[model samples]
Target: MTIDTTKKIESLIITDQEICTLAMDVIESIRQDFNNVYYKFLGGELKVLWSNQNKFNAKASSSGDLKSPPDHSVTLYYATAIRIYRDGEDLYDFVSSRLNKYSDLFEKLNLGEPSCLFKDLEKEHFVKNFFFSGLTYLFGHEIGHLVQEHSYIRRFFCDSDRNLNASGEASEIEEIEEIEASASSKQLTRRQSLIWHVTELAADHEAITWCLFELVRQAQEEESIKFSQDDWHRLKENTLIFSCAASCVHFRFNGVKAVYPDEFPIGTHPHPMLRIEKNVFQIISGLEFFSTALGINSSKAEISKYINKGVISANIFWIEKYFDKNDLDSGLLMLGGVINNENTKKYMGLIVNEWEIIRECVESIKRYKPFNAGNQDLGLMFFDENFKKEFTK
Candidate 1:
């Protein structure tokens, strides 16, 4: 949890091809969608691979500069990929072992017995499918960074002498926007930090939506696995569950104080729990994004169950895996405190407001007609009528 990733120490690096191959397989599984939906959309070749770095981290970077075409790379460190895979399995085993006590919870969420669900396939399918979704998210997240073309690449082309304000002509300090105001250094520093936070969240939104729809595309098109109506529903449920479980695993690595910057200069990425919890809304919108083409027809009530129970699943695994605690009630209580904290609410508002402010910037440049991650430009606010109803009804 405390290893410095700045420098690569051969003593700590794990270049095991097998460990890296699991992530590769996930990319391979979704390659069809990846290429079809993102090839030209991404601007250049997007290379995703495993890193030998020993840290529990992943990063998106590029090599070319202003003179040359940029090629983006998203590398998942071996330590990060391996831990996420293992932690995901551990979380599932922990919950499955306690199914007796949580039978009501499982039944309410339509969670099928792992053994039964995978009986037609390999026993490990339960772990692989859900964990693969988690892995898919990690890869997609890096790609999400590339899709945004945020400050990282802004220096090359965004030569405007003005902030990309969403509405007003006011000056702002954010993402290489060229600070034009006489704002104090502290205010600029603080606002820059906030912009970085919003930048990370925007990528998270893109990645999570990419992840859900990719999962939808994968599940719908899978020819190897035939599912009955009930089994199809269960598959959808677990896909949603492990997506959150993956967030818990990430939180386990990043620590829980990530709710807000005041919690301690939370860096580019927000805490995984806050990222996980609020993204249920994103998942809802994402399903709607792909529902028409994919024929995803879950009701408002069923979608509600997925989000409610997903929170329960994430809280349990987060506490058990991170705090080394097992009391479900206590875990839920702790989660409530984290979510309801005034600072967290404030941080949430910051992202929402910043999102609106920068909406024009992203939409103007983003090439649209997603197969359907950000299906369209204004798809920023909502995916469709169904997405609107999920919240309204």
Candidate 2:
């Protein structure tokens, strides 16, 4: 099979006139949100190209149609987004009508009232949340990939035979143990285990952070006034979205519970819930500490007087109780390293250097149009080298 190596990859954004403006607004919002947090713990550059009213009438695959998925981009076509799978220069394939499937599932979940006016748009919010979660999951998965590069135990798991050898019936445990003696040694350290756990937690955090931003954007938009109890009910009904979204909500709720366990019952994904509780609480609590570290005090409102900037004042106290300066510094170092890594660009499949791409995107945003029925652009803020220091300092 001959591959069209000469074919140029293009960015496409698809949407009908009704939703196109809103979708574009979302695209821009997503871009700004991602860019703003580019140096944070869960931040990574995602080159999701926005294509509207895409003309490509691609067929849906049963389960595994795409041979090789592309590393860099996503295609959002008129509510139906398809991720492109690239197999070298030989093949490129995509999914068709993603919104249709999500919408169908949304209906299946019976998430809203029949009288819902922005019913279709509500589904978009849910779908957007899914994307946010997926992106976070991908980052964690990518961290897994990176860890496997140097992980001795992970290398064993990477081999199917090793996995089979590790798992056996209790009756066969003795035999497996005997066989294990003969097997090459590959042990896991506590640190390694913690690293793996943190990786997953980081991914979850990333997804939650993205979702929070999305929800905030919606809340700020007048068009999203249509979002109602029915919409919340609908969101809670979808299995996939509900699971991911619930996990985050559960996490926060758990925080409140931890402070007052007599109030709420336990739930699923408790580890994630606790972690979220800790992370969020800690970050908020530690804000004062961080502010102290940077030698900035807003208590007198002096900082605000100089320049009214968004100072995350709510969660500082919680983070301070659980976090040390070392922990903050370590996380910041890891985040900064990843943000500055030249290899991330390779993983993203960028042609013109990432720095250049970012430069261009920043320039383009000057004229960015808001996605429909909203003025989300009001929140758009650009950051460069100076702003990159926000989290680090």
Candidate 3:
């Protein structure tokens, strides 16, 4: 609902072909980046499902003497929607209503501010927005579940109804298990429930990264007259961008604050000041401004100034407990080196070094306990590493 003068509505809208093309390109990149276990861990099997302006409609028909129910899959439903029917009418009805409500919200919100989920389907980037910004990001969350291996551990912790959904409505123990495996990998263990929250965060971070890419790409083609003119700055501030990925990031940031009171007394996720100070804002800002690989003439001095003034957004307690300070500090330094550029790709070599350091940091963090390969922790590690590497280097 906020107004943004920076974006042109036309620039934000991509044609159906453009959307599919970009989405497929993104997906292909993902496939290349992830393979086998990593792919499975990252919810790879789900792939990218594209929908045209052809609205999903449920129809009733009689195949034989008996009338068949609606074809739910074709309808606007989650990948989890199929199980709703078996759980009984209540569950089915509940999901149906929820989906409809969200659909309505999508319409009402008109998140056409490029990369927002509510972008109209008739537009081009809508599919890309849904896939890269919305779905892929969320799928990464599901990958978090896999990383936790919730299912394997579920046997030891779960009660008798291992098949039951969280609502305890139906006996989809296997279906639920498979869905969990396909999306989140496995059900969460009692001790690992919090991991689910992290997965959501991880997904958010991934989604944000991709969204940044999309936003940057969109900005470059602005002069072409093919894109929508939705104000990018306004869109950035709308908060809906975080509704999925950022939402999880916020949740875990809060939870980690509560649970690890001593270690993360302030919080797990970076605080607003720190987040901005650390150029999380600028990274996003950079992503917002640098719409093309050709690069844009933008000022990052304002961003650098902010980060330099803030308290170091690092918690030594947790860093010592879960990460080696030497590695962690080195990682940050490497990232800073890359993102430190004034505007041009001046720090390309440093960016490459940042990537190496970040990779090591990520592997180290994943090997640690509590987070022991949990979703958000790894996500945080990756986010810190990649952004720092890409931007500054």
Candidate 3 wrong stretches, greater than 4 Å: 1-44, 47-140, 143-191, 222-294, 299-380, 383-393
Pairwise TM-score winner, candidates 1 and 3: 1
Model 2 clash tally, residue pairs: 32
The per-model lDDT (C-alpha) reads 0.51, 0.28, 0.31
Q: After superposition, how far is residue 393 of candidate 2 from its true place, in Å?
A: 34
> Which residue ranges in model 1 land beyond 4 Å of their true spot?
1-17, 28-43, 63-68, 99-123, 153-188, 221-235, 256-266, 288-297, 324-340, 367-375, 378-393
Select the stronger candidate by lDDT from 1 and 3: 1
Looking at model 2, which ten-residue stretch has the lowest summed lDDT?
86-95
**Whole-model lDDT, candidate 3?**
0.31
lDDT of 2 at 9: 24
Question: What is candidate 1's lDDT per residue for 1-393, written digit by digit as tens?
Answer: 001112222332233455466566656555445555565554545566666766666656654242344465666676766766566566566655653565554564465432232234322544455446566666655555555656443322334444432122333322221111111133323555566666656666676665554454444434535434554464465555556655655565455332232433243345655666556666755555444444456665566555556556656656654453544443232334444565665665565665566766666655433533344542243324543333223
Alpha-carbon lDDT of model 1: 0.51
Write down the worst ten-residue block by lDDT for model 3: 57-66
Backbone clash pairs in model 1 (N, Cα, C under 3 Å; residues 3+ apart or in different chains), count? 0
